[model samples]
Target: MTESLRISSIDLAQFSESRDRRPTERIPLTTIIPRAWIGFSQAPWRFVGLTALMLITVTGLSLISKDLQQGEGWWQSALSDVLFVATIPTTLLPIVALLHLADQLLPSIQSTAQNEPVQERQRLRWIFRQTTSLVLLEGVILIGGLNMIRIIGALIARQSGVISTVVLLAGGLVLILWTLSQTLALPLLVHHGHRPLAAMEHSRRLVQNNRLKVLALLGLLIGVNLIGLMGAFIGLLLSIPFSALLLMASCRTQTPWVKDSRRNMLPT
Candidate 1:
């Protein structure tokens, strides 16, 4: 079916629940998030629980940022880096601590079935370690070995003026896309018990034609996150929690197959 028609006729509620019932089909992000919100909203407390977890993690981000602004020397800078690294553990701990709540992220909409929570958690840990272990390992490995490379590159780039600005904008866009592509696998990893690469491939497959749409969503996420940064303490206190509510809301639309199957199953 065509994309436009696919969206136009899609029934989001049925899409969410039925998708999970299928043993082996891909589920779109559009389908998964909305359906969960329906149930989540009915109880509301579930959403509060979900929002609270996100709030704590975002709170950690705000806390470390303060120390980072104070570091000025080699030792002071090193201390700041250590504080920064410490925060990573804080952001993800909520998800790990309350595995049951992760369903908030998983849409009722799923296609094809995959369940390997034990394996998935192990994989999630590994992937987090691989991708993030190095943000700290980043310090140990490349920090001293190529210390001047970053310094020299900055100096050379500074001389390019207008050319640098244009190039930087292009580079920034590319980096954002890459980061989103890499991290897109993350929600799936948590929700589907998917291994890292499998989750990534799955995310790419579902989002293929919808890359622009997905990217727009990513841009919205980033914008909200940036706003959170500016809000800092207040952001942690309210912005992240509020944003999670909005995220749940915005993610609540329906998909096609679920509507079709529901129509078939219901007696007229």
Candidate 2:
């Protein structure tokens, strides 16, 4: 018993040491996002990231229904808005995860045929192709779920006026949960080699202990999400880098599969 206690104490001391040295910062931009995570994690790169943000914004546009009673083309506009909005989550989340996961899984550059420009470019092309397939594979999940959301929303809207506030509230709650689930998955896939859906489970696990921090990150990301709405439509790509920073910072901290990726005092 005494020996066991001593061993436990020693382990605790080492864990404490890791925390001190690890780089877990709240602000993402300050974290040095792994170059591979930001690059290979994506395909057609900027295009997919931009599309993801745009889809999210599309969902946000649903709120415009509040303007329905005030105008001439209100109902018609509302119909279009709802349809487009419903498409958001279905169209983007999985694709975004695709880019994020690929980068995490195959995160490195390779060199073949030294001193040959043609060979280097060919290798680069091959790498991009592989990355693209991964991106597409993950995209299927993203698009499918997003469409499901749209179908449900459409059915609800079909019931027409007097939409139940309770139902709406419940729905909003579910959507928020879904978003949180998506957020958690990225870290697991990137750093831990979890499958895409598996990443979602791990994300939930990571946040089990640090709910407040995860909530805080969610709030911060939401702020960027608002910006993304306007920015994606305006053709601005600022949120990509901002998100990259957040993801890196998140990886360095306590996540579902492991604890304290940063601040290592003892041997991990």
Candidate 3:
């Protein structure tokens, strides 16, 4: 069956109930970081391959953009525009891949300590298409909203510096809050087959009460990546996946929906 039909067949009400039952526990960085290490140990090669793929694709795109920059003609200009548009979607490839990997890894982490049987993996094509759609939808909404804020800020700046500064600051604050609220969106989409908007809304509600904890989690992840940078970037191969696993752990621990889905996947 096609993916659309399969998704349509899922009972969204049950999914909604599962999400609502998500625990309100605070996700400590200490707990999640260790789980991330365990997850990486389970699938080190897969995460490494994903990181390598992202680096290679980005480098290739940078080289292509440099070549395109040298062209000086109407056709070249048009080509550059096309490349710019193409790159937006292409650049999201790694993010989508990481979400797919996280979806696969979360179940193992949950079951491993319990000595429970894990579910068989989903087909790669299904995971790829689902994650790609989720990433694109989220990316468009975020990027479009940020651009609108910037444009409005610029217009206000032309009239009043103080007002424009306030507008920009408010916009930045909104963006950060929006980002924190939607922290569980990808996992919601992967685990429950939720539509993009519904997943985002659920994520917002899930993290609403624990906003500070979410912020700290995000900051900790960023700090870990910065430390990886201190290692001359080679450390990111491990750090990136490490952060991703922590994210999945956070989602799994807080979201009853993910836990329920994993339970259902076990042998009857």
Candidate 4:
């Protein structure tokens, strides 16, 4: 019994030491953004092509919608709505490509950390399978949340005007927080093979003490993409991948996966 107790105590100490050695440092936006640009440059042509396609589809849809608005028929509105729904899946295509790019880039980043080359090839079939589920899950979550918020807003609006304003503000705040919490979900899913709910939980935990940094990174990506729009939307081809790499870098730096690798290297 005494020997068992001693071994348990020693194990606890080792566990504590391992936890202490894990990096809690956040990657700076400056580092991540620049590296993201480098990653975009190195990305495969397929990713770039997909991004371009999405941009073209969106632009074409916008033009069509504008033309439809100039017409005066009940069918015009119905057609516009149909076009809008069709565009939703197109938007997910770029996102799917981004996630695959991030997953491919992660091993290189990890290899750099370990000072060793990690050769891993991305399977196109796997990427497609994973991306389909992820896109569907995200679509459901976003659509469901927006609908709930809309319903709540409507119900509040039926009450006092001032109260309705407060409710709307609160709802918006909640939505923002929820978004921030899930910022790392896609990366977690892609890199760690976590399920939808698990990935979201992991993301929430990872962002717990680093919400501000995450929000700053998100803002930086948005600003960069907006700037890209200045170049006739052609810049989005670069910005979209760049932002994805930045997000992946952020996730890689914060996750405990690297520390786990280090622990595995230690004498057991």
Candidate 5:
């Protein structure tokens, strides 16, 4: 099926919940990266264009914030602080949007077939609801946990420098693991119609059995983004899409919704 038609026809609620709960096979990076590359290759400019737009907005706000901070006025500093805070959402919104787009676009590029039809308006509404709810839920949990860790670290710092350092390191490690475990939550929600908390729970479970592979995938994506950072952030235009595509692809492989007979034939 054509990409647009396939995307439009997807019924998010039709996913097999039983299969979703089952353990996903570990997809080799060898298969994932090339498939992601091909997916991106098929439609580079749209993804790149979206990233470029985000980059511009983020960069512009950051520069404006810096300038405001340097200005000789109290209100200027306050406004700069607001702008600085705005940058976080500015950065996150694009990423969430990109992931939504990648989720829709990737399956067709990968030649996965689904047969359901929904209107464009309905799809947009579904995506918006899912994305917003997931963002709010995930953001609160992660931020709350990190803040608690920070508070604990601060308390420890008063007791002993070395011990505080150790505590902070351990806490950071815990947060990293927690973050990794929820990596698939967005894909789960957008692709499979999972509720926010349910998606997070499922993602945690999925990551638990495949911790090492998930870690490797994260490391690879991080390295790619880091490389992109070195190029004056222009590389993010490509790297961001590549990362999103790979992530969506990995999620699909791990929690496929196809029939039993076709499971073995899926591109892993």
Candidate 6:
């Protein structure tokens, strides 16, 4: 028992030391996308399959909803909004799963290899917590904020279209930036086991520290998805998964994996 405790202490020290040393590390801008390509290649089918399922379910629902399709009356418009909000969870779950899949394929991205392994049960629990928190937080900020802007703009529209337009544009820009900052949250949760808020905070810090890299990532993904859009459904299948992999690769690059040898830590 004493020896076991001593070994545990050494492992804890090594883990802490590695984390402290990693803050200065950064992956080159050019390599992040390329690394994601490699990750995608390793599991192309899995990526495509998950994306396909998400797309089918979401598209099918949208197509079948006559009220949403017509979107004519105020009630229909409101119902359309509800249907759109309903789809957010479906979208989020797949994204979380994609990140998880990427982490599994590229284990080096996760810190668990050096610590206590996250069990299947714990993984599921984390997923539930992450999904619920993100849905609530993002819904309030992105959806609710947009609604607030619309309301405020409408209320003040008699005064000036220019002011209303400015408010809408400014609110949109803030939300876009907020969305970008959250790029790392799921990756952080899957790789490092951070709770939702902690993962979000860490993601924000990472994006702030590496704005250029994150921006480049987003730009590339948007371009890729746009091209995918041109190809119709087939293109999205590849691009969506590829985007998830790229984010995971970026997270891996930010925090390189470390595993200290027990032999090296034994008192000399």
Q: In angstroms, how far off is 29's CA in candidate 5?
A: 3.6
lDDT of 3 by residue, 148-244 (tens): 9899999998999999999989988998888878888876665566777777876887688667777788888899899887886588887787877
lDDT comparing candidate 3 with the true structure: 0.70
Runs of candidate 3 exceeding 4 Å displacement? 1-29, 107-124, 147-165, 254-268
Residue 213 in candidate 4 has what lDDT? 84
Model 5 worst lDDT window (10 residues)? 107-116
Task: Report the C-alpha lDDT of model 1 over 78-142, residue by residue, as the tens digit.
Answer: 76667676666766554443332433433443422265778656755664654344234434533
Q: Evaluate model 4: give its lDDT.
A: 0.69
In order, candidate lDDTs are: 0.50, 0.52, 0.70, 0.69, 0.75, 0.74
The candidate, 2 or 4, that scores higher on TM-score is 4
The alpha-carbon lDDT assigned to residue 154 of candidate 1 equals 61
Q: Candidate 5 residues 44-82, lDDT tens each? A: 888998898889989999999999999999999999999
Off by over 4 Å in 6: 1-28, 67-85, 107-118, 143-175, 255-268
Evaluated against the true structure, the overall lDDT of model 2 is: 0.52
TM-score on alpha carbons, each prediction = 0.48, 0.39, 0.70, 0.67, 0.73, 0.68
RMSD for all candidates, in order, please. Answer: 11.8, 12.4, 8.6, 7.2, 10.1, 8.9
In model 2, the runs with Cα more than 4 Å from the true position are 1-175, 225-235, 255-268
lDDT of 6 at 107: 32
True lDDT of residue 73, candidate 3: 76
In model 4, what lDDT does residue 200 have? Answer: 81
Number of backbone collisions per candidate, in order? 13, 14, 0, 0, 1, 0
For model 2, how does the per-residue alpha-carbon lDDT over 1-268 read when each residue is reduced to its tens digit?
A: 9999999999999999997765433322233334424543444455456555665665555545445435577676767666655554444454444434333333232213243878545644443444344445556755676666666666777776346444556666766665665565655454554554566665666666456777777776677758876856443345554554456346544222245433421112
Output the number of the TM-score-best candidate.
5
lDDT of 2 at 45: 55
Q: Per-residue lDDT for 80 in model 6?
A: 73
Runs with alpha carbons beyond 4 Å of true place in candidate 1: 1-36, 46-80, 95-173, 219-268
Q: If the candidates were sorted by their TM-score against the true structure, best first, what order would they fall in?
A: 5, 3, 6, 4, 1, 2
